[model samples]
Target: MAESRNEPADPIVRGTFATAKQSWADLFKWKQRVAVTNDYGETYCEWQSPRPLRNPISLFAQLSARDWLFFLVGLAAWTADAFDFHALSIQTVKLAKYYDTSKTNVTTAITLTLLLRSIGAAMFGLAGDKFGRKYPMVVNMIVLGLLQVATIYSSTFTQFLAVRSLFGLFMGGVYGNAIAMALENCPVDARGLMSGILQQGYSLGYVIAASCNLGVGGSTDSWKTVFWIGTGLSIGVGLIRLLFPESKQFIAAKEAGGGHTSSSPRAFWIETRKMLAQQWRMCIYCIILMTFFNYFSHTSQDSYTTFMLTQKELNNAAASRASIIMKTGACVGGTIIGYISQWFGRRRAIIVSAIVSGLLIPAWILPTTERSLSATGFFMQFFVQGAWGVIPIHLNELSPPAYRSSFPGITYQLGNMISSPSAQIVNAIAEHRTVTAVDGQPAPAYGPTMGVATAIIALGIAVTTALGPERRGRQFELAKPAGVATADEIEVKGKLNDVESQVAVDGEKPDVGQMENVIVDDDDDDDEKKR
Candidate 1:
């Protein structure tokens, strides 16, 4: 029943916004529309009934043992990545003092890392597609662990920046591979829940980092201990990855002739070229989408604790406590909203979250006391990250199989690169407006600056997501490896991956196309049973 992609037909429709501004006159009336049809024959104004949402409990129960393993491993990798990165952000004040520099100078380390991650994503994502998911991921995690150790030993601000810049590259590579490893073979019925849980790894990392900050570095000059802890976790995650095999989706793709075609480096270039040639528009759109997303997250989070400590003049413990509360909300909200996205649709869920987040900006920033700020931070992040929960599955569904690693990873990192200076930009803006702290030192007006920036970014995300297409429940089972699946086949077959049949974990064969098997390995006799 899915549309074919072996040949070009028409673009998927979200709305007419993209084309409306081709000329000034047409732009004025761009909103006017006629009945138009997508390749799937769904009309623009069709009144379809809402898809029913799955019970969260039942959805979790449906996963096979392999599915759980893949999910947990991927989650750990992502969580560690976040933990390592946020350690730097959380220690900006201590880092500045340690290196005898301004807070902005210390924050430049964050900017440099963000700037270079696209390069890392490119390097490792190619390796992922060329080789397999496991080794490349292992390499990335190991390098990240080493870099964290290097950060702890940096003798100068320049050295610290250099180490973190290198760290960014390796850090950038993990997201694409992690999401692909976790969700590529996930059951269609459970993807929303899994996506939600996976995205929370970032928030979970922030919470853990805050807890560490409170426990290890509270009023102590020992920011080095935090970095050391991050290094240990990163190394531990790398080792953990070794215990799990490569993703079944990657295994099946390889066996079916995707990456298995050639061992030469040229094969990586050729495959990447072909994927971009067909999916360039989607890639560009995703980058633009990610630009707003990264801006929303970094703008809201990276400078928040500083804002609390410096501008609000709160104690270290109070700032850390508030951050933990905010990120905890982020974790809980992302999970709930991600699950809701299964039936509510990706774009709709994102827009709704964005709207609510924008509405909460006043309370998020206006609260003066630590207790009020903690409450506001919790609700604010709940919506901000609730929108983010949809991103993993949304991006995964948008990606072509051949370059699953490269497409999403590169695009996301590129977006990160574009928005890399968010903290600095906000800091620069805040510098123009100063306030006297209770301790008599001058502080930037971080609360007002962040409040304004978050509101605008929230609106931007809502509009962008509204105008973007959604591929909910897209198929993942392919008839052949990605190398053999033509553009036409990829586009037409979409997420279904041409797995015309499905076998359940219970050993009862489902009707053809009724369900997807999430745990079928290539060597299994049940390979056919899954698809």
Candidate 2:
């Protein structure tokens, strides 16, 4: 047999700029159905909302027991990564005190961590794709555990920054592997709900880290205790991953000879370059979207506790409590909004959430009392993370079919890289401007700085989301090369030429509804074997 058959090209999808003229008209054209293609082609139709809403439970029931286990494990790994990273962020106050440096200087660790993550994402993400998701993730988590411990040991600010920079590298790889492993096996309709829950792993991490800070007390050295807790979480996730098999989808694709699953170095590079050539546009768009999103979360959150501690004169315990409450709202909103995106359409949900968050910015920071601040912070994160809930699935759908792991991971982290300066900038601006603290002493003007910055970011998120492309239900694992089949896909029903499409002869592409699966995933999992 020939080493490989000719691979079919991706479908023609509209780029963001190409659709700009109709952007205004398209907003009102919600009734139009989204156009889809079997392979990338020369022309395509506009993005639109789907027709009917489905019950979230009914949509959720589509996954097999096997799917649930994999998803939960993926989520655990992601949560651990978040927990490890946020441990440092939530402890910024104590770290500055412990190091006897300015708060702006302490934020340098956060900046270094965020900046290095893009490199880690690119390295580990590609490793997950070319080799397998399991090992890259396992290594990332364990190394992260070590780094957390290292952070606890650092004797100087320079040592701390260096350790955090290393921490960001491993931490960056978790998102791509976790989402690919979690969502690739899920049924199409369940993706929005699941993506929401998965993305909340970050918010959930923040809540837990804040709670850890509260439990450890406000001693300057208490930050190390939180880091210790982070160490346990990271190591624990790494060990837990060791118990699982390779992704069932990865295994299936390999057996079927369908995906770019070749473990060969030569095969991997060839496929990688081709995917980039075809997918560069989608890559740039995802990066730009993620830049705004990373900025959205960091600007509003990283300095929040500091804002409370200084401007509002809340004690550390109170600031931590408010943060927990805020992220709890984030958890709830992400789950609910993610579920709604199933029927509401991904882009629309994001736009509405971003806009609502902008309107809430005034209240989010203006509150002077602990309870009021907690309430506003809670509502603010609900919309903020609710907008974020769509991202995991959105990036996956927009990725090159075979490059899902690296594409989503790289773009998301690159966005993180671009927005890496968020915390430092916020700290810098807050320190310069003066505000009257509750104690009647002059303090850094955190409240107004956060409000103005967040409002601008919220508006940007809304507009960027509106103008971007979405492929809500793209099949990551199922789609095979179009117009070509491996000799292994024995179940393909038509002649090789006819399989190209019955209407291709007339120079017209068939409707997506008329397309066939052509191949089923490897039925080797226990659930499928039992069937």
Candidate 3:
């Protein structure tokens, strides 16, 4: 036999190892590099690298003028959408009186608005993927503005309901599209803050609505004036949106034949099926959890604040004033929660807020003088329902880009649809309980029922947190890379690589200890793991 062969030069093996080492170095250096090679093309750079800038201050410093302007555009769109919704909130009680209906009937209208808005959201979501974000957003605004103008002339309950429901359809498009537009426009590192800031528009709109409704004096028709103002604002925004540029990512995806143009009926159906199969469970859970609590909170707090006050023996004017105070508190409270989420992380922030809100619900059941109840009502919105401040942002983040609009649209609408009926349920229950005007105190039954619902919903939220993913600072692309390894493939390849590398370095068989160490280190902690 020939002399025992010395190890060959193994140039290919050496080159592969060297390439791997370089890749490892780049990964550690905080720069991301992607090398793409096709039949006639090759390029490499740190185009996909994610920078580490977590705080608002850092985000502000780093964003370009274009990015800043895009953010402002997002804020304006969201503010307009939120302003329209909350204006309805302020006018709900007054509308009830105008229609010669109970507070419960008004609550039903609010519920229908939410439900129909979800339908609008789903329609726009599909449309956003089919067309582009820009045109659809403009369409939604124009439609909503027109509807608002029509709502001004709604003289009958059917006409009012029909106009509001139609408006809801377009309202759906506003939040989802605005969120998609905002998130896609921001740099990956600044995503959380930018998204959080955009969400603040809702609170700001609430404040504007409260101020406008409070300052303006009118009969039932005065509510029409509010709709007219909303119409004007929406129309102005729609004109601005018509001028806004399409997102770069959206444009690129379209150019690559990977976006709207590439979609086919068969492909769309398949994608829909996949989305339903993969995501429907989570969607159902979210809808159930959100519906129970959101309906309870909104109807009890926003929709029925005036009615609740009247039940407690306050005059109609006093009840209306009390509702304004509660809305003011909501504005202040929601803004605080938005900032707090930036600090504590979204999931934890929501969990803590929910629990605290649950604890505060029992306070509604306690005995209080009229003056005390009004005071409590003002702060109650700040604390007892503050968790909702984070919801629009939270729901948007929980979804994947592929079906972001669809998933949120379905779940949110479903929740609203389910909650719509609660107005009737709660009213029926309150009617059943005796309301002896003793010491100017309303019956405690409604409060106790609300408190129980709050606690149960809080528990549901806490449990859901266990199943929810932590996406606070992660890059959205990393969560769902284009044409990359599946999650399972990544796990398997990572394990095999560890084994092969360990065997090569030691010049011996792989040791179990090495495998054990890899398992322990690679496994994320339960609290920190992505959902």
Give the CA lDDT, 0 to 100, for residue 449 in model 3. Answer: 53
Model 2 error, position 100 (Å): 1.0
Task: Score each candidate by Cα lDDT.
Answer: 0.80, 0.82, 0.62
Error of 3 at 150 (Å): 1.6
Please state the error at residue 387 of candidate 1 in Å. 0.6
Task: Name the regions of candidate 1 deviating beyond 4 angstroms.
Answer: 1-50, 257-264, 436-442, 479-531
Report clash pairs, candidate 3.
Answer: 469-531
TM-score of each: 0.82, 0.86, 0.71
Question: Lowest lDDT 10-mer window, candidate 1?
Answer: 23-32
TM-score of 1: 0.82
Candidate 2, TM-score vs. the true structure?
Answer: 0.86
The residue-by-residue lDDT of candidate 2 on 1-531, one tens digit each, is: 222222332333356576543444455555433444434343334444464767777876888898998899889888888888788888888888899998899889888989999999999888887777899988889999998888889998889888888888888999999999999978887888999999999999999999999999999888888888989998998898888788888667655653432245765677678877877877887898899999999999999999999899999999999999999999999988988887787888899999999999889988888899999999999999999998999888888877778889999999999999999999999999999988889999998988899889988888877777666666568543222234443334333346466676777876544443333332233237568
Model 2 ranges off by over 4 Å: 1-16, 22-24, 32-51, 257-263, 479-531
In candidate 2, position 166 carries an lDDT of 87
lDDT (Cα, tens digit) per residue for candidate 3, span 37-143: 23444332222333333666776776777667666776787788877887776676678778998766776666778777767878887777556678888888888
